[model samples]
Target: MPRHRQSLQLTRLKKAGIRSAAMLTLLTGVSGGLYLADNKADQEAASAEALFAEQELTEASVNGWSQHNVLERKVKAEQEAAIAAAAAAEEARKKAASTTSRKSRPGVTVKIPASCNEYSGNRAIGCALLLEAGFTLSDMANCLEPLWTKESGWNHTSSNGGSGAYGIPQALPGSKMAAYGDDWKTNPATQVKWGLSYIKSRYGTPCNAWATFQSKGWY
Candidate 1:
């Protein structure tokens, strides 16, 4: 009776040990599978975070480039405007200078008429001297006025370098007028007196001298 009872207890103990080992193996496998799944989820979350950070950096670089381009364009535009303003100012200055040059010369603006009475400055002095020298008004207006105007424009300082002529009557070797007065070179009255005397001696009349000048371009 004792031998049979001991053998049955041993068999029960062996069956219990086998069931415990199987339960432990199942638990280990389930735990390992859960750990692997958790690790995969964490890796996916990290990849998403990295991609978002990279996208943010790219957008920031693009915005910075756009801002730089805008600033560059603004500077270029300002430079162009400054250059245009300088060119316009220079052109205006040149125009003002030309206007001033034209205004300064009174002879260039006043045209001499056939009527000697309307004359001013050097021409008026010549007219008075011609009347005093016994020349008729008709001779003075039609011949002497046109002749002197053509030769020297009544400018006492006028000279022709090629012909060696000078003053109101286009006197050749102008020093010849010094016979009339010491100030012949600068005084319109002295030049007028010398010119009238020369016409009386050589051509006899202003009309005759004018006729010669018209035909030959000189008298």
Candidate 2:
């Protein structure tokens, strides 16, 4: 009874110990597999996060560059517009100045008539007009002769075709002598009075008027 029972109990104990060791090994292997799977998942998540960050940075940089380009283009366009406006304004100002200058005083050209001739009546009229104006005709009679001869040949009705000048003094439009008398167009005395006054005001004397006429061909 003792030997058989003892042998059976020993065998049962050995079988129990072997079963426990197998269970522990299986649990250890499962735990190691679980740990490896968890570590791989964590690494994948970290890589995905890094990739997302890189994409965001790239997009932001592209946006910033696009904005800079737009701003630069806008500035360049504004500068070009301003330059064009300034140029236009300058051109307008120059045109206005030119128009004003032309409108203020117009230049006149001189012309002589083929029928012009010396008339003795002019000398008489010039002498009387000079005496009335408090000037001595004897001192300025020589200069007056040549001046009137070249201008109107002492003819009160003398007229210029190019400059529209008329009268003994060749007054432009002939009507300018009307300041002396309403008969300036036909009266030799009136024309002579205006002519003498013009010489006094412009050249101070008939000799000076003659000198200016000789130098410039006009006075």
Candidate 3:
């Protein structure tokens, strides 16, 4: 019986959050049987406090879980920003390299492409050049093509041996092409640019002017 009583007392002390020293002091002042009963009562009160503390701790644990998930979202956002910055840097590098390659290439002149100059030197280049300046290609073929064929056979060097009108899309003074640029005689592009401006200001488009010229033969 004594051994059984000691075991019960130890169990109660463990549950009550009491130390071995406090239980020993209580046992020395009271009979062993009375000590056991008081130990059990204290244990019941401590058990109630422990249940309440456990409930509070469970609530705190839930709060910690919410905080952990929020931190994960922040981490993912930062990672995406880093990836975009890397892609932008790579694109800039490629563009810079392309510019450098163009600059270093041999025999690359900044002058107008052969397509532009080829037509420039042709006596035929004069009228086509001017028409292309303001209006589109369709405007040239529709408006100027037929009229010029009739007027001078698409001749740039055509001159009126009789009426004093000269050149393709002949103005009274073909020298008037000099108004566009100093190189009008040699630069088809400049002459074309001037001619288109003149046509637009005067007849609107070659087609509109052509219509008038067809009816009046002087448009």
Candidate 4:
């Protein structure tokens, strides 16, 4: 072989090796750039997903709070209604208690008094007094018959030795009957008037007074 030909071949081989190394460096730089860009894209996608999840949680919290508020309002409304109903019922009970007439109670029958006479004694005077006081029912007379009979035996001047009670109604201190008249100590009519007034005020009716007398031995 000729020396010149061998040297030219060696030089061409060295140039080819240099060109391969330059191509390899260019390809490595491009691969690194592509990898970095892909990583950034993945990070952006993850951030977007996290933001969406947070928004969903916030919306759920708001909705839950709204529902709780509605439930609380409903309970408050119910409580107010119950309070109003109770107050209204109390007012109605008070009005009924004050306005109702005692005479209008059922099973009442008032008695009309017979004329005053020497034979009839204080009975006629007592009947007249009860009639004036609105105790005009037969059943009322029945209740009074037992009540006054136990107290004074229908006697106008009946006296209690132990208690100093006197009169048809057995007025304690006897002077208590003076509210009706000055003749309370002698007049059977005045005593009876004061007696009926007392029974009406304390017991509402003769029947109620009789009930008290039966239970407690006094009206």
Each model's lDDT: 0.84, 0.78, 0.65, 0.78
lDDT score, candidate 2, position 65: 100
Clashes of each: 0, 0, 3, 6
Candidates 1 and 3: which is better by TM-score?
1
- Where is model 3 more than 4 Å wrong at Cα? 1-132, 182-191
Of 2 and 4, which scores higher on TM-score? 2
lDDT of 4 by residue, 94-203 (tens): 88885564323332222444532322567766666666777764633678767888999988789999999998789898888766666677777778777888898998
lDDT of the structure predicted as candidate 2: 0.78
Candidate 2: how many backbone clashes? 0
* Model 2 agreement with the true structure over 110-130: per-residue lDDT tens digits: 122222223245575566556
Q: Positional deviation of 105 in candidate 3, in angstroms?
A: 31
Per-residue lDDT of model 1, residues 50-138, tens digit only: 99999999999999999999999999999999999999999999999977765452321123345566767887777777777778778
TM-score of 3: 0.38
- Model 3, 1-219: lDDT tens digits are 699999999899787766666778787768766878889989998999999999999989988998998998889999999999999999999999976775453321123334434333332454445433555556655676677667766555677877776555566676676565554544544444555566779888878878987999865
Q: For model 1, what is the alpha-carbon lDDT of residue 21?
A: 89
lDDT of 3 at 203: 85
Best-to-worst TM-score order: 1, 2, 4, 3
